[model samples]
Each structure stands twice: as C-alpha cells, then as structure tokens.
Target chain A: MILRTLRLHRFKWLLLTGYLPLSLLAAALVGDPVRWEDVHWLDVFGEGGGALMVLTWSLLILGSRPAGTVSNLLFIGLSLILVTLWQDNLDEFWTIPDAQLWDTWLENIPMPVGMAVLTLGLVRWYEEQRVLMAQLSQRERFMREHRSIDPVTRLASADYLNQQLAIELRRARRECSPVSLMMLDLDGFDLINRRFGAHEGDRLLQAVTELLLLNLRDGDLLCRYAADRFAIMLPQTSEAMADLIASELTSAIRHFAYRSSKEGERVTVTASAGVALALSASPEELMQRANRALSEAKQTGSGCHAMAG
Target chain B: MQWRDDSLEATWRSPDTPHLPAHHHPALLIELAHARGIPEHRLLRHTGLFPEDMRRGEAMLSDRQYRRLIGNILEYDTGGELALVWGRQSLPGHYGPPSTQIHNAPNLAEALNCLHHWRHQLSPLLTPLWWHNRQWCYLLWTTAGAGRRGPFLVPAAMAAVYGLARHRLARSLDWHFLFAAPRPTSPQPYEVNLGPTVRFGAGVDMVVLPVEDLYEPWPGRSQTAFTAAAHEAERVPALNGAGPTLPEVVYQSLAAHPETPAGLDDTAGALGLSPSSLKRHLRDYDSRFQALYDEVRLHHSLYLHQVMGLSMEGIAERLSHGDRANFRRSFRRWTGLSPAQYQRLLPE
Candidate 1:
C-alpha cells in the first residue's frame, strides 16, 4: 500500500534524488573537501541516524498513502527536513566558505517552512482518518453478529463467548493491557430445579443473568457458559479490579428477588463467582482458571474467588 | 433539574470537518449569508470550504464545518438570527430529492412520510424523529453534527418546516416550537423564526403541529406527477449505512403492531420473499431473524416507554412479557434504567 501511494509522487522522488547530488556537488566545489584522516566519523553517524529516520518515515508514508494533496504536502515537508539534516551532515565532511553564505541558504531556510507544510498535511490527514473511521465503524462494529444465541438464557452461547474472548484478548494484547473474566454459577441451582420446578428454576437463572448484565459496564461481554452458569469478559481490567466487580455482581444477584415465571412467587437467587485475570494466557486457559475458582467457591461455599494468573 | 440534550456528544464527529450533507445548497447558503451582508469569501475562507468543492452539486458537510461558517456569520449583528433567514429562503428549492418527493405526496402527511422514507437520500446525517397522535405531530431533528451544533439546527429546521408548510402546501396550521437549551436573553430570534408561540427550556427540541392540518392537499396537486416523483425518490441510494434491509423493515413493522406481529413466514410473505429465502437474505445482510425480532422488541420497549410515555405495564404488555417485573429487569439490563426512570431522563 505504501509503495503504491509513493509511486504517485515519482517526480518528487526524482527531484529529491537530483537535489541531493546537486547539494553534494555544491559542497565538493565550494571549498576544500576534508581529508580522510580529518573526517569525524562520529558526526556522520549522529546526523545520519536522524536523517535516516526522517527519510524512512517519508518513504513509509508515500508507500502507504494514495496520491493525494495531503501526501504531497507531507512529502515536500519531509524532503525539506531531510535536506536540512543532510546539509548539517555535509558541513562535517567539507568546508564551506563564509563569504558565500551557501550553508545558511541550504540549511536554515527550509527547516521551518518544511515543518509548516508537514503540520498542514497532518491536520488534513487527521480529518481524512476521522471520516474513514466513521465509515469503517459501520462495517466493523457488526463483525461479531452474535449468531450463536442460547435459546433459554437469551444471551450469546459459550462458543460465541470464546470467539469474543479471543477478539478481546487480541485487542488487549495489542494495547498491552490486562483483560479480566468473570464466571458466575448459581448457588444450589439443582436444588432450585428440584424444589421450585424446573420452569421456575429457568426463570430464576434468567433473572440472575439480567441482574449481572445490569451491573456490567459498557463494552463488557456476557455469555451463557453452561446450563446455570454465565461468563463475562471485562476488557482493560486487572485481577483485583475484576474481583471487586465480581463481588458487586454476587451482591446484586444476592439481593435480587427473582420472581417465578409460572406463578407469581418471589424466588431468592444467590450466585458464587470466580474472577480470573489474563496474563500470557489463552482464552481457554483463562476460562479454565475461572471455572476452577468457581468450583472452589462452590466447594467452600464462599461468595467469590479471585484468580490472578 | 431540567432535562438536557447535551448528552448528545459531538466528540465522534470531526471538528472543522468538510463534506456537508447534500441538503444544504452551498451556493444558496453562501449567497444567503452574502445577502445578509457577510462577504461570500469570508464565509468560505478558513473553513477549508470552497465554491468549487460543491460544484459537482452533491457536496456533504459535517455539522462542525457548517457550525464554523454559521458562527462566523453570527459574529455580525444578525449573528444567531441566520437560522431563520436560511430556512425561510432556502427551503424546497435548495433541497434536492426530498423537496421533489414532497410534491409527489398527496397531502402533508404523505409528504412527511416520503421525507422520512427517503430521508437518507436527502442527507446521511440529517435524521428526524417523528411522533404523532390524532391531535398533534411532534418532530425532533438531529444532524450528524456534534451536540453543540444542535441549537443552531433546531431553529433552522423548524423554520424550514414552517416555510414548507406555508409556501409548498399553502396551509398555515397552529405550530409551536420547543428548544431543549435554555432561553436566550434576546428572544427575538425565536420570535422571528417561530412567531410568538415558541417555548424554550422545555427539555425537548421539537416542532409541534395540529394533526388535522397535515392532511391538507398541496396548492396544486397532480396524481401523475406525484407518482413519478415518489418513484424517482425510491431509486436514490441511501447513504445512511447500507440502507434499511428487509430484516430492519420487519423490525420496524413489529414495533408498530404492538403485539406478536407475525412469524418469519408471514413477514417473508409481506415482503414478497419465501420464508427460507428470507432467512438467506437475512444471512446475506448479516442479520439473524430472531435477533432482529428481539432487537426491535427491545428498541420499541424503549420507544414506547420513553418517546410515547407509555406506562411500564403498557410497554411490558406490548412486548408480550409474561411479567412486567421481568420486563423491567431486562430494561435495566439494556439501559440501566427502570422503565419509568428512563422515560423521565429520555431526551425529548
């Protein structure tokens, strides 16, 4: 893409290449060139490093962007900045006479002017990217269409959860941030099924799920992990923070007076949660750890557990 | 505390953005500013807008850029009053397919109907939320501009609608305009654009109209011309993000019925597609059938309780919920608000 965009500015590259040689020629003719013994290698390395970076940026931009007004401005600005660096480096190799004032004309003048053009291009590019992001968001936002919805809970299924977990993990890794997972298992759900009739138990589970969702922050993902279990992915969250959120969820569900669907009766629902933090862990590994903590909570009859792996 | 529309953030929209929506005529809008005494070049300058950029006659502009231009004009004595004049002079003529669609409709109601249906064809960013009953029609307008740009557009749109009613349909019905923003110290702008009946600090920005007068026919009506114009409007590409697919149409239909509207087969038949084919078409559109149905149900739940101010039980019943409490929980999940509370906080 960068190459294709740079191809449009063929004349600019040609002129840039031509200008470099002409400057070198001007330096070679202006005064006596430095002898091999006197040439300071350190100055060449210092100035050359900065010039290389700038030149690389110019090439990268040209290659990545299409032929447009902004790209042209960027190229011109970068080219000017590159020439300033080149002249500074050139002064190290060759001596220029003070009478000619060629060094000032070549070096001092173009730096600010070039910088101004680059700034102008950057502003326009920002505008372009904003428009593109809005246009792209329409298509991108729906990529995960939530096709695998669980019939009973009316939330996305375990498979969907895994897919979203993977997506979130990739994003988190790119951003170098932690992602936390919350797992909730209804305490003594089987007993509710046995006591309140399976129908009432289903309603209780649905109500509990809704309660968890109500407490969830925006951009949190909720999914049905099992028959009476739920999983939620909290992006950009640490283990301690995720544990705090799990406690909030446990309390919210604990306090919720879920009513029976078949008959109008208040059914109390309490949940045990396991919060797991991701650090060099795959989605499956993260889920396994959370489920492990969840089982431990169920064993110990504790409200929640935080697993910081 | 007063309800505010400032919750409508302008952050996502680019500041000093170009590409104004197609509804506003650059030549006409710029010239209108000129007629109001601000120089044309001054209007175009610094906004990165040019007369030539709009020469193709299909230029789109973001609200930010348009706001800057309007802000510049507002610097003069006629500053904030530019909206009324812009609406008065620029309606019907400067607007494109929407204006043409208006004449094709048999009456004001159908004209508004055509406008709503083909709204994206008019402009991508300009969306009008319409509510009506037997007695009155209320319209709330939104442009893609950030929320700060909203106040300027509110008066501009209401005045333009007034111009449309008076000039095109030749019907002068009783109308009241409301602004969600606080009332200005000088109320002359509101008076001039909307006359004496304007209300500000009302917690909703809308134009209210007598429902009966909307049925009034245009000054000159022809069935043949109306049909031709409506047909043409239908063919225009909707720039509003992939346009409304069949599933979206079904979702919208379900909202109005207020009951279990229809199954997939029946909805498919209505849209002239086979049930299996409808499923495939939905897949093509990247939508699932049941999800669309649920989405519409949730959307209408919010719509009924918030926009229509329906009771909790009423909205609950409309969605076919077995328990209103269950519906309330789901509403909380969706928006963190119980139905009644959401209704109170909902922007008018």
Candidate 2:
C-alpha cells in the first residue's frame, strides 16, 4: 500500500526529499553549533509534530488515490506546506548564518501559497464527489433492480429486461453475435378485465406467462414489459430464429384456452408480437422501436412482425 | 457534543415499513448538510423533517420521504466519496439503545451475538450471519431488501464495525473484508478507509476473522451495563415471525454452493430435517424450493463467471460437477453459447 502511494506521488515525495540535502548543506555552511544547554525540547516537539501531521495527511491522500488532477494539486500543496514546517522545525536544532536569507524565504513563502492551492484542490474534490454520487446512485439502482421480478407474471420486470439487454448489446458488439428481442402484447386485455373480474384477468396473465415460459428456449429471458405486454430477450439468436419464435408465440397465444374461475368458461386470447435485433445501447429506444413495429402489425391485424433496427 | 445531546431525543425508528422516520440520527443529517455548505431548511425540504425536529420531536417523515431528501442531497452536491464520509462520521451513539449493548459486550463474540439479536432494532437492512470452523470465523452479511441504499449501506456497516473494533480492541484484532460486487473504478477511498485487506468480487460480503479475535476482551467491559443494555434492546419492535424464513434459509444453502449445488435431500439432511419437513417449511413461505434453487444458481453463476472471472471448468468444479463435458453442455443450454464463446463476448 505504501509502495503504491509512493509511486502515485513520486514527484511530490522527490521534491520533499530534495529539500533535505539543501537544508543539510545550508546548516553545514552556517558553522553555528547547537549546545545541549541551549536546546528547547518543547519547540522541537511542537514544530516537529506539525511537520509529522502534514506528512501523515499527505501519505493518506497519496496512498488512497491514483494520479489525478485533484490528487496532484493536493499532494503539491501538502508537500509545500510540509517543507516549510520541516525547515522551521530544523532551525531549533541547527543555526543558519544571519546574512543568509534562504531560510527566512523558505519559512515564509510556502504558507499562504500552499493554503491557496489546497483550497483549489478541495474545491475540485467537491465537484468530483458530485459525479461519484451520481455514479454511486446508478450502481446501487442497478444492483437492486437487476433481478427484479414482476409479481403478476412471475417473469422478470422491465428493469431486469433493460439490464439484460444492456449486457447482451455489449456482448453483441464484442462477438458480432446477433441478439433479438420479441415484444408480445395481449389484444384488448382491459376488455377481458372489465368483462370478467381483475382476479380472472390476473389468472389469465399467469396462465399466459406459464405458456410463454414453456415455449421459450432455455437461454431466453421472458420479462413483463408492462401491463399485458411481455418481452423476451433472446441471446445468440439470428434474425430468422427470432422470426420463428415470434410466429410460434403468436400461434401459441391464439391456441391458449384461458379459463375464468368464476364462470368456468374457456377464453381464447390472441396476441400480436414485434421482434427486433439488438442494435443500440438504450433499452428504452429498442423497446420503442419494437412497439412501433407492433403497432404497425396490429393495424394490419397480423399476428407477428419482425424488424431489423 | 451539544448537537448530539440535542438530537438524541428523536425517536429511533424501524425501517421495515415505509411509514417510520427512516433516520435514527438527525444530527448526522445536519452534519452531512453542513459539510456540503447547504442550509438546514434546504436539506430538510421534501423530507417533511426540520432540523429543529432534532431538538423537539416534531419532524417525522416516511422512508419514502427520507429517500427523497437523500436524492436531493445527491443531486446538488459535486461528486464526493459520500459513503466513506458517512461511514467515517458514523458514531455508535447515533444508533441508539441496541448500539450500547453491542458496544459494551465483554468480547467480540458476545458483541456480535448482541448485534445479531438486536439487528432488527438498529436497522432492517443488514443481517450478519456467522459461520465458523476452529481456526477462522466467517460473518456473512445479507441485505434485507435495502435496494438503492446498498452502496452506502455496505460501507456504512463496515465503518461502524471498524470504528467499534478499533475503539474497543485497539490494534489487537486482525480481520479483512470481502465484498461480492465487482471492484469500482475508484477503489482508493475504500482501500484507504478499509485498509489493504479489502477484497472485491469475492463470494459474499463477509468479514474474515481469526477465531482468537473473538475471545479478546473489549476495554471497559462490564456485565452489569451490558445486561441493562440488552434488557432495553428487547423493547424494540420485532416482526411477528422472528426466526429465519424458509426463503432466507434456501438462499443461504444456495449461496454456500457456488460451484456445486446441493440436492434437496442433501440440503434437508444438512439442515437436520427430513425432505418432507423441508418441503412443508418451504410451502409455508409460499415458494417452491426448486424455483428458489434456480434463482440462486442463476445469480451465483453470473457473479462467479462474469465478475469473479472464473473458467467454466473452474465454475463446474466449484458447483461440484464431475464431468467438464456435461457442465459445458448445460452451460450452452442455459446461455445459448459454449463457455469459451460466451467468455470471448466479455471485455478483457
């Protein structure tokens, strides 16, 4: 960990260490010697302590982060202040000649300048934090909703659908693999709920979900896109394969005899579907394209429609 | 200290329902706002909470409302390491009664036990599950459906434990943290705060500790104070069915086997129950064990293969498959591509 930090802030550390030799040379040239009787242990502790604290803070910031603009600013500022503190603390043990002005310049110059740079670094850090929080929020939302289930159909929810689609699209882009989405909508589902009770409609939805799941390929993720609309995410599937699945789904739904528990009556439900190959990053956009095709298919009264976008 | 004294009277709430005031420490909220140089009124806006509520018990808001406040804070502020900052500032006193009991335990084991027993009172989010052999102790943490707050919650929980341990035992204890999530781009804050031992993309969010660490006594351990604290802990509201639910048990069982799945009979035997009894328990939870098993398998495979970067054979061996060929076939059937092909699809 220390090694990583050293590497991250090598320039700052080098600059700080470079002063050690200069200080030693200046002390040697001064020729004034310190006596045991003249030593102020209290001043040594106070000045030395301040230098050590600054060093610790610098190490902490450097160790935790990689080289970035904010980190660079912080390290530079901290090092500047650290040098000033260290040189002032050294005056207690060694004497510099009264004629030499370098020590006084070192003691006074870096204080306000260091503080100004540090203030700038802190301001940048605050801005950087806002971006991180947005990213954090997105990450947490992704984790929570990644495996969300639709209570009605016992299928994956729209959130999960979008997540999977994003993954599939990235993979598709990488491997040049074809992934497809099938959007299926039950025809006039509200009419069924109005005619029968909502409970009966719910049972029909469940039965339809079961039928869809049974018909789906092992790799397919069937998701509830919205009320009465289902989405199937098919990975490693060709355009031809997607068309076959869409037609199969349309026929299967048409053949589905959903019985209402109240009247024990058989209700035949027909569905229109639109299939699209994965082409974009935005799951919403993909869904919209599929919906448009479905709406067009509905106008023609066709059971299924396939489009490449 | 005065801010704490003033805010301490605000009621500690159960986050189980959306109705209660989600935060236990309003002072922390004020401090977070203050750090950002935001006004207290602006911070409390839409939360139906006032900073004055910390003094006089008037500001009460639902979980939904509190979440909105968090959302607002997040929206305006420049990106900062909010979770680490929050964790660093988390004092045990902010957690109220249950925290006192957890803090005063004679040793780590008793402290952990106290924490486990009173967890529902502190927060409904984290439930620490303990598993140990003779040498090492494993405390696996599972979430109680705390969705979007998970990013903050995980680190915050770690910070709390870290602070408590440091205060009580000094540098006497040795432990490392493991998280199931993939490593983030900026791991510096986590590395700095959690030290070098933090591992991401691991099996579970767990704390690995030597068995000896549990026996080390806490400074200022008192039996009298602990007993009183525990007594007060009991007054916190608990769910009707206090024991582990069947789904939770099944999830644990599945989580235990990332490479090899345990059969129904085997899992039942492991639980010291018959297969029928296991089935009955699962039925009471309104879910089939098979469905739960599939869910766990799907989630585990995604983590191990995608995040942990394990080979298909390695995953198969972990899942306990005898034949690599059989595993390959099953993998293909599940994903519509061979393991190697699927791997090629992922970025390096």
Candidate 3:
C-alpha cells in the first residue's frame, strides 16, 4: 500500500512533465496544411487561451489542496475539460478525412459538454472546500497565535516567556501589584539521555512541561527555557507565594518517573527549582536572580529548592 | 516463574522447532502450538517465517503456509492434549461456514439463528447472541485472553469477522452496511469492503440486517447447515481451555510488576503450561496473554496519566520505562493519540 501511494505520487509528477511536452510535440508535428491566414487563427488563440486560463485556475486549486474528495473530483473534471480543449485546438491544425464526421462532432460537442461538467463539478467542489477551509482555519488560527509554541509539546518557548514577561511587567506596574518568577532545571537530564536514548529524554521534557502547566495558577505563564529547564511567571503573587509554588513544582518533578520505550524501564527524575521575587525590579534583574537561585538549588543536590536571598 | 517441563523449554530453544503437519489447518496449527507450549516464533520460523513477521499480525498467512507450520508443531508435541487445545484455537473464521449459510438463508431471523448456533466453531471470545428486547439476537462478543496477544488483535479480529461476514452477505444480497468502531480514523478499504458508514469507537459491533428481509425464506439448505454447524460448534471448546479461566497468571504478575521481563515463554512457564498451550488457551478465551499484558499496562498507564493526573514522565517511570517517547507511542496505540493530545481531551 505504501509502495502504491509512492508510485501514484511519482506518476502524477511524471505525467505533468511527460504529457505536456508530448502534447505540444503532437500539435507542432500536425501543423496546419492550409495557410495560417486561411483558418480563424485569432479565434482559435483566444478560445485556447481562455481554456488555458480556466485550466490553470483549476490546476492551481488542485495543487493548493491536500488529497481529498473535492480535490479529486475537481482534478478529474479539469482533466476532462483539458482533453476536450486539446481536441478543439487540434482542429486548428489538422483536417480529418471527409468520412470521419465523428471527429468533428467529438471536437465541437465534447468541449462544451466537458466545460459544463467541469463547471458543475467545480461549484460542488468549491462548496466542499469552503466547509473544509473553515474548519482548517480554526486550527490555523490557533497555530498562528501560538506559533511560538513547541509543536511537539504545545508549550510556550523562551521567546514567548520574554514577551509575556514584558506585558505582565507593565500590567503589574500599572496595578501596583507584585509578580514573581520561578526557574526549574531537571537534574541529571544528560544522564537520562545517556542511559536511555535522546528520544526518551525529549519525552521526559515534554511531560515536565505539561506537569508545570497543570500546576500553574490560572493567571500564571509557563515557558520552556533550555532543553531541560523551564521558567514560570506568577502574577499578583508575592515572594512567599512564589516560594510555595516553586516547592510544589519541585516535588512534582521529584515524583515523576520517566519511562523507556525500547524496554519498559522506569527511572525516577528529580528537578531543582529557584524562586525570585519581582518587587518593582526589572524583568531582567528578576530573571537573573531566579537563575542564580536555580544554580544554588542545583548545587545543593537533587530535589532542592532555593529562594532568592 | 519456574519452568515446569524442561522438554518444552528444550524444544523452544532447539534450532529445528517442530512444524505443523501438511494436512492440518492453520487454525489447528495455532491451537496445537499454543496448547503444547511452543512459542509462536518457533512455530512461525519452522513455517519459514522470521520473528519479525510475527509482529505484522494483520498480514494474512496463506493456508498452505499455516498448514505447514502446524504440521511441524504436531510432529514434536506428543505427550499433551495441546493438539486438541490447538485445534480449538486454530479454527478459521469460526463463522466462515455459518456466515455463508446465514447469507444464503431467506430471512434475517433464520440468518441470526444460524449465526447464533455456529459462532462457537470459531474462538469463544465472542458471545454470538445477546438478549435484545426480550429476544435472543446476535450482538457484541468480547474476546477473552485478548490481553495476551496484543492490544490491537481483538479489535482487528472483530473487524475481520465483520468484514468477512459482510462480504458473504453482499454476495447474496444487494444492501448497504456500515461498521461503527472508535479506533479507525480513515475510511478506505473499510468503507469499500464493509460498506460506507464506518464509524469508529462506536462501543460495539452490530449488523442491522434489512428489516424487509426478516421474513424471507431460506434460499437453500442453509437453515439445516446452520443448525448442524451450531451443534458441532458447541462441542468445539473455547480457544483457550475448559471452564471459567482466570486472567492468565502472567498478566496478573505483569500487572503487578510491569517492568519485569515477562516474555512469552516466561509467562507460559509460570502458568504451568507450555507457551503454545497458553497461547491456544488464550485464543479459546478470545484473547492472547501478551496482548492482555500490554493492554493492562496501557490501561494502567492511561489511568495514571488522566485520572491520577500523573505526568507522562511519571507514568513512564511507574511502567518501568526509562523514557517518555516510548510511552507516547504505546499510549497512542492504546488511545489513538499522543500523550499531549490525550491531555487536551481532558476537561480543564
């Protein structure tokens, strides 16, 4: 089945390149026997160009779409119309024998029939596409607003944290309230990756991010800092409250059991957390203090919590 | 778990694992090996299948290959009732004949009765009929011992049975059908093969036979065959064994200790049965033990992840996994989503 799909995709590209050139060559070889002036060349060019524009528009719709029912129908319809147009264009060059009245009917009647069918199919296709696009747009909007989110974990990144910090800092200053920051670093994360594969380690990080998000207050903001570190911003909270939250976060990480995929081996993961007060201090200063406290916690060993002095 | 019979272990370790006899059916071969304590891999290898091929459970082995493998296993297993157990497990499409007969029957009621009687010829994992509005009717049947095989096996088997039954009926009747299940995400072969309206996670498998066809007469002698097939099917034991069996001992042990190295042979030996016998026994119960273990583990893991609100890393830890990625894949298989997506499904 996988091979068949690959072949289908391959054939689509092959047909695009191979058929266009072959069709053009056939048209060139079957050049007009009558002088170019004898036939209605201008009318042929105008009609052909109009058909090409319609065909190009349909092809664009097909190209921009993901494989789906409406796209497939549109593609089939476009192919039929294109085939009919090709036959119509062929009449400008070659004159069939007198006995072949069927070719003349095929050349003239099929194009209009094909065009009508294509137009009908496209209307249905457009309606279907609109519905799908609406649903897709919701997801797209979510993704766009959360572009700074880690796709694998759906957690905010460091850049998001910085932006949120700036916005919240202004709000806190305006409201005349305190906001605090917490930094958490998973201890021995490198050792974890070394023991298990790096993939498992990444999973551990993702899980940790989720855990932090779950534990955060409604107004709190969380972000992934480094590979194994995270930062959280607590609004309308004091240093004492941040200290309590940081301790809870540290306990959660300490209790976390990271599992291995290849073999179901469970390894306990611990984290060291640091809390710093945001008492009218700049974001950078608060961040620096939190980092310092985090370093202190790490130095103190596994599952340690440190508060800015 | 101590190895009860050293000879069975020897056979498993031996280079030339016993193969199924030529005349034996594929279902019988599976039953025999499962009954005798022969590992699926050993039987599969003797049939010219590599260990890797066993992983692809959905891939159908030809009847010829199935027969050859069973023949080899029967060659070496002489002392046990494993062959009988194997026979019970190996019955192909326990519903194959009856399903076909049912389709040929004139009326839906007759067809339903035919199915009810003959369903036992296959594995007993399914209950052929259930009480619906005070009348006995074909409804959902749960596969026992499913945990031992793999999480996907029972669902897959259920799908195959429905598909096969639908194909047989389609041959005789011009009617549309739909399958409702929760796991299947896309509609391709399922739609084409089972008829449109393939809904997933629908809670159960059911056939809404055309209401008009309820009073139609049997087309041929399908009614007689269905009755005879049902009686014969009753004598055919459930895939695993006789009587009410507990969850395979290995599953309990593994559930108790998910991190333990409870491979196929280890669990079989622990249960005082051969691996082949255990597998066959599981089939009768409408399950395989290995699959059960995985299911239990996954269920527990998911419970911890969602209900207990455990972190993925923490859940992985309890499962004895060293990493979360492996947990994510296993969880996805269990619930058709990554851990993050599953978390999203939970109410805030």
Task: Provide the lowest-lDDT 10-residue window in model 2 chain B.
Answer: B1-10
Better of 2 and 3 by TM-score: 2
Least lDDT summed over 10 consecutive residues: which range in candidate 3 chain A?
A136-145
By DockQ thresholds, what CAPRI class is model 3? incorrect
Tens digit per residue, CA lDDT, model 3, B1-348:
110112222112111222222332344345334433466666666466543434433233432354345456645523222332232123223334444455455555565555444432233223333222212122333333432322223333334434333333333222332222354322322322233334444323333334344444534445566566556545644311222223433444555555554777887776677889877765544456656666556545644554466788898877765677787777776556677765553323
- For each prediction in turn, the share of the native Cα contacts (below 8 Å between chains A and B) that it retains comes to 0.00, 0.00, 0.00
lDDT of 1 by residue, B186-211 (tens): 45445534544676655456677877
Residue B1, candidate 2: alpha-carbon lDDT: 6
Task: Locate the minimum summed-lDDT window of 10 residues in model 2 chain A.
Answer: A135-144
Off-target runs (Cα >4 Å) in candidate 1 are A1-309, B1-24, B52-79, B94-96, B121-124, B142-146, B233-348
Q: TM-score of B chain for each model?
A: 0.61, 0.61, 0.36
Clashes of 1: 12
Q: What is candidate 3's lDDT per residue for A35-147, written digit by digit as tens?
A: 66677788689668866876676656655665656555566566656666766666676655646665566556756666676777778877886786454331222223455
TM-score of chain A of 1: 0.52
TM-score of each: 0.36, 0.38, 0.31
lDDT computed for candidate 1: 0.65
lDDT (0-100) at residue A8 of candidate 3?
Answer: 38
